[model samples]
Target: MEDAKLTPRKLATRIGVAPKTVERWLADAELLPHARNRVDACRALKVDEDMIWPKAVQERVKTGHDRELAHAYPYRSACPSTVWGELIAGASTDIFFAGYTNYFVWLEQAAFIETLRRKIVSGCRVRFLLGDPDGEVTRQREAIEDVALSVGTRIRISLEHLGRLGPLDGLETRFSSPEDAVNHVSLSVFRFDHDALVTPHLARLVGHDSPLLHLRRQGDSGMFDRFAEHAEELWDRGVPQTP
Candidate 1:
């Protein structure tokens, strides 16, 4: 108030409120400024409304129901199988999968593999970046899980399935290294065009037990862009499997 050259009486008079009300507002942090009060304060103080009332920032930023960060759906302690089918089947443009051992599950479903093949035939670019089973990062994760060779065995099985798809056009598969920070990743990302399903790894828990986030890009930024960039970085650094 001092910086704004505002005394209680001056601010109250400028906003057409009681000086007592201004005193109350100053005494209590929860006494938020009304919209009109904010406007009056901004003009009188020669400062932005946000500077006068910072709590209302989120209110101003949350433009639409689908446009905010809180719009992401959190699936806690559960990984639904149907989610994969729905996301993959509905994808029209592209599909990118980066996981520890996705093949052990995806390869078992003939329908899923066939659907991917169909998508490839339709000119959709499909990329997979799996963790290197023998990599140091994988070993560390195994220790965290307290399971010996659990991550490595899964990776090897996933690689076998990937090997079968090597001859197919529009399909790319590679293994990502954990040591390479630029390409090193800790989260599992399944991006299908504008929508992405993300699973952030929690300590001492495997991916399946971790919480999942269903994110839809409202515009060209936010969580979608961050995860997409990470996936792309990993993809660029991925080592291709030899035929």
Candidate 2:
């Protein structure tokens, strides 16, 4: 059977609604990627000036794709109340963090990071791969250094810089495919001691759990390997984003 293809307006007509309504869903919701193309086609199919959705509609769809990845990943949660539990309470997470002037920003999880620090104090093999340009990461590293200095041999840090890379995560993370979309997120990725992913987004930017998408299992194994290699390669490069 041929694939179903319909203009957003035609789809709206078939579904007995206004074209703008269709555009609304496309712009303001967690729509599938194909919906991206669909929205463009639909906008072009505008019956008249009144029928055309705002250009912002389609652009917002593109701009918000990063925020929409969470909807693609399946989220699992439990009442165990562990640091990981709260982070994964939804299906998937896409963290949008804005780094400071020139430092990486850890996804918004003060509680979880604090928990990880306790784990580190207990001799956990803690490794952090911070993006060099991120001011947040730089400040956070200073904070860690202060703690380490105070501890004075109680905790040992094994630091390896990954220079300046888009999106950051701790080591031991199984790197995945790059998001082939625009990203408004400042904080890219965060993991809890290499167990689960952590991402930070400004609350209320999107509705509750709106950007938290269920991720599809990747079909390309090579993509995963390439991603892993790229991350490791960057770590080896170790060119800081600053002078």
Candidate No. with top TM-score: 1
- Report the Cα lDDT for residue 23, model 1: 93
Error of 2 at 27 (Å): 33
Each model's total of backbone clashes: 0, 25
TM-score per model over all chains: 0.66, 0.27
lDDT of 2 by residue, 1-243 (tens): 012367667777765667887677668745433444455544545433223435445554533324323333222221123443454333232221111111212223344445444443454433333333223433344454454232112111111121222123321222111231112122233332212332333432211222222222233333223333443443344333221
Q: lDDT per residue, candidate 1, 129-227, as tens digits?
A: 888777887777777788654887887876776676666888888888555522343588888888888877677777666677877777666778888
So what's the TM-score on candidate 2? Answer: 0.27
Where is model 2 poorest over a 10-residue stretch in terms of lDDT? 151-160
Candidate with the greatest lDDT versus the true structure: 1
